[model samples]
Target chain A: MTPAPGDPAPAPGLIPRDSLLPNLEFPFRDLNSRVTPTECFYVRNHFPTPALTAGGWSLTVGGAVLHPLRLGLEELRSLPSRTVTATMECAGNGRTFLSPRPRGVPWELGAVGTARWTGVPLSAVLERAGLPEVVAAWEVVLEGADRGVMTEPVPSPGEISYARSVPLAKALDDVLLAHEMNGEALTPDHGFPVRAVVPGWYGMASVKWLTAVRVVPGPFLGYFQTVDYAYWEEKDGLPPQLRPIGPLQLKAAIARPAPREVVPCGVTYEVTGAAWSGEADVARVEVSVDGGCTWADAEFLDPPMPHVWRRWRFRWQTPEGPGSRTLLARATDTRGRTQPTCHDPARGSYMITHPLPIEVDVRESSP
Target chain B: MTPAPGDPAPAPGLIPRDSLLPNLEFPFRDLNSRVTPTECFYVRNHFPTPALTAGGWSLTVGGAVLHPLRLGLEELRSLPSRTVTATMECAGNGRTFLSPRPRGVPWELGAVGTARWTGVPLSAVLERAGLPEVVAAWEVVLEGADRGVMTEPVPSPGEISYARSVPLAKALDDVLLAHEMNGEALTPDHGFPVRAVVPGWYGMASVKWLTAVRVVPGPFLGYFQTVDYAYWEEKDGLPPQLRPIGPLQLKAAIARPAPREVVPCGVTYEVTGAAWSGEADVARVEVSVDGGCTWADAEFLDPPMPHVWRRWRFRWQTPEGPGSRTLLARATDTRGRTQPTCHDPARGSYMITHPLPIEVDVRESSP
Candidate 1:
């Protein structure tokens, strides 16, 4: 269906993967700042931006709680607020590179961006609703105002709200009910009024267009929870089990010397890129210029942060002869988890953290 | 382009993945014998079957050889011949199951079959061409009469002949230039006159429509050799390298109780399937009836063979309730290599040897 006139439009300079549901990708080649500009941030929408007004909208917290609470935008803003600089990435980023390409948005290494999010701590609101000791083993289900019919992987029953669940511990730890992005009010495309900012997790966990929160006694088996963002877990002496995908894998993507870009030979070129991990701080980044034959360490441009991406740069002395070359970058996390050189099919199309080939041609002389 | 009036037509009951290219998949569900019927064998074609007469066609052997020889079909058949009962499967046999569906023929699970291949051993022909001791470190490239433009992970420069290479050791071992299949002269769709049958490799390595064989001093980097049918190889502290795919991994496929088939509950059902491995003989076959929660050993109907598939069956006692169910099978080879519970993305769309889920439904009563 064509987007309605009131639907949010993607900002210029963003690569559009889909138009109706509006999945925009950040052009990584334009990565020039630590905090992606509001207009430059990638937008991943499961449905058209819901027409929500802050004055009329309310977030309802209920289910398995002693005291159910409903709070409007004004009340939420009045509560204690915190700001976090984090990088959010779609689980399906860099999906196009998968051979025998799996079905999806066909993202190409750009569905990620870093931004400063300002919001009220979810624990404060949950405390107002009175979380009992019994809820420690339960889960907090977050529901979004956005609803749509999912068609890929499997068909859903009618239109379903975008909902996911997090461990009660995680929800009460660092989760945020975000209302401001990069010091500005949240735009409609950015989940106006309020959204969830799930640090250290994939972007999908940060449900956009927040509407409701519920405490459940068991695992949430919603479409997005069990089916879409899930991977097979194989254990010794047991059958492989399907588990929900959680943290991001270590990854580094080259943004400069763009794919197939022509550069002059015999010159020292500065290769720049970004590295991020969901589990720990990025400890090191390496660049391989001659098709993985040799590797050199890159300098990190950003300080080590828990959930923020670190910008990195490397200098390379080009070959004297003109020829084609492939550049690859790999990131290693503080936990010793390094980016895999090959895609893991068990992750399906999600967690595409493999070191990808970025091809470039070196010319004898600059044109 | 539409096939000419005389173009080879797929046999009845064969699943056609591409009508124009004549890529016919075997109906594996009808596998009721040790040897697949000639008409039921799977046919994977890269280009339209070239019209050739046995009297006019000849096989050429040259390149890095002390003596070069060209022989006609009758002369080739005059040499010592051997018969091999082997199972050949397309590397992308189960590609459709890959999430974020990969681009290709979209084959489900039937692009495989077993047949008795009859012809002269490639070693006999190479011996006539006089392979010198220095050729031990070289490769033997096989060229086919079939030619076409390839547009996939990357496009080819122009129309190129279907070609591949094997190590000199392998070419002189069990490779075959076969002119007959299942006790009958090969049909046009099956590469009439001659084709190379590499016993344990994926179907692509068994180049069809044999035309020329060349011994190269080093690695062969043809489009098919390096660009396609290749996977990323990862080693400790080394950059990932692209390597040509060789032998198949262990795989087990359920053929009976077809996917989503309905069966009566509280009844004894015999689940049947086939298992094969390229590296070693299948050591064991296991079936999981409860969504991988438990597994039971299956009874192998065929004896262990080096390059042949073994059929197996499991007796399942259906639950006494009506509901949906999933069936899974896994195979382990003598070399301790077992079918992985998940797809290894490193193999790309090829080597899809994962233990696949076969879903079915259970009814209160037989309908």
Candidate 2:
């Protein structure tokens, strides 16, 4: 039963961000485990789960290829497989924190998760299908099975499938036509039959329930590509510029002893969290217990692993003062990339990897 | 050029721990990068490098299999491949820190590194070869091409190859017959043609230049498995009990502002370092700048990637007075496993992931 207005509806263990479309987040504290359990993996869908089965599912590779081919599950699995552990974050992961909050899913810091994905490389499939002649003016279009209708910014409304396009070089780099996740078959909520795993890009580029792969010459102005994912902004009294969102920016968040938690004063508690980036490896992570006054570097639990998020932890000794305290964390990558302290208001609803602060109230120690 | 008695022979970038047999360590500070570059990766060779080529390499999967099979490089590459990022440490990684150093390589902390390995899962190969009937007594033996003469505990000296055996369950678990490392083909020093990547285990379990996979019944007493890698000791008038070394223990080390470093007082500096474990994910890492009087949790650069090492850093505010100081770090894993403050003298030199203390001298500020 729905409670009050603006209250998220219950969906098992999910922290629902919106009542509609089932956009939800796994409680960040449950991230203690290495790989996010399939049941706890975050779910973000544009439409209802598609009705499909592995028996009837097939991926079509066409357009600009010397030999077009359609591969079933068995055929795709026959190719040499590769596995990678990677983290994926929704483009609007921290949308709720924006000033004058954005008009989308009000996500907190739980919209990201990491997993081990196994599949055949897109390049291997392209090479097996006989690659087209090398050309600079080529783009790869990916279309998922989920389709719906949109009303906003439309003159003539029509049905459209969830689709996006990437440059030829990126599609051929490390993208995977994935079939398994975390050593098991994909679940229905996470694109049951097949999906695209684009290594360093935002979640939108990884279309789920994938069905078609098109190697098109020149750009294709699809709805998701041209209208939705691009950020339009008017700067300095000039004409508006539209820039499409791409890689995920560096960011960190405190997960344990979640936001606004209360604890006993003088007790030592552990402050644990996660940090991630799109393409670059994290070079360093610094944490601050007294807001941002004094920062201390936290110890990473694991060695640096490419393309995957890293877990970090800090121990905080609460002073005897019975008052509110704040904790903050920030990340930097090897490519000299860092999270911005403040975001540009013009760039809304995407790539928000800001260093979020968590508040905790310290009470007098119990007798 | 041989410089001195203990100087390791020049082998490009390897930091020699021993002069004769190429026992080396990757410079610990060089671990700032995510994946250790091949040139700087630590090397541990028991004998001269073997002369083997991929063209002549054929892995024989025989013994207890229902249908034994021999696979060439092309055939192995044709199978489904999987990739994982994992940390591997020599059993004697911190041997130098042990009091009364054992009669082996006096290695420092540089004997550990993490990398992305790509290969076929050992389970898949076993299934393809037709797994034998279920039996609790089954074991898997892996033999490498490198061989040398043995001189200890023998009536007659004989030649023996590098070999080890593991329980069937572990052999079938996430083990990979790795052929590539860090997105490229493996190098000569790092087992060029192929090797075993036994995730979460010590480096000895991952034999380099792997040549044979035998499914043997009961236990196989290979030299590396029974004699060298096991820890044998007597306790309280009891018979000498032997336990085989398996997973890596939780541990951490300060990488920067190294031991005996001199820094100006009254200046705030950042302390950087790394921590890792065998099978378990690290739960927390605490740093003590003032000898263990007070402990502060260090910040991790990233979330814990399963089976990989983690980088960490901390900010230190040097006291005004100039004197001697000590820095120490200890790690704990999710399984409630923590590094011991002091080791039992009887344990000797293997599996020492203990909390290491670093000495530093704070100097007065320059006039």
> Can you write out model 1's per-residue Cα lDDT over B33-133, one digit (the tens) per residue?
76788888888988889998999899889887789889998999998899998889998898988998987787888898888999999988888899778
Misplaced by over 4 Å in model 2 are A1-367, B1-12, B152-157, B233-240, B365-367
Winning candidate number (lDDT): 1
Task: Name the docking class for model 1.
Answer: incorrect
- For the second chain, the TM-scores of the candidates in order are 0.95, 0.91
What candidate 1 gets wrong by more than 4 Å, as runs, is A1-367, B1-12, B134-136
Docking quality (DockQ) of candidate 1: 0.01
State the C-alpha lDDT per candidate.
0.82, 0.75
After best superposition, candidate 2 residue A244: deviation in angstroms?
71
**Per-residue error (Å), model 2, residue B153:** 8.0
TM-score per candidate, chains pooled: 0.51, 0.47
Candidate 2 C-alpha lDDT tens digits along B1-367: 1121112233346688877777779867545666777777788877667877889988888778888899999899899999999988898887877777666788877898888999999999999888867566577888788878644321111456777777789888899999999888887777768999999889988888888898876555454643356664433221233345778778887766666767778877677778888778887888898998999998888688888878877778888898988888988889987888886543446787667777788888667
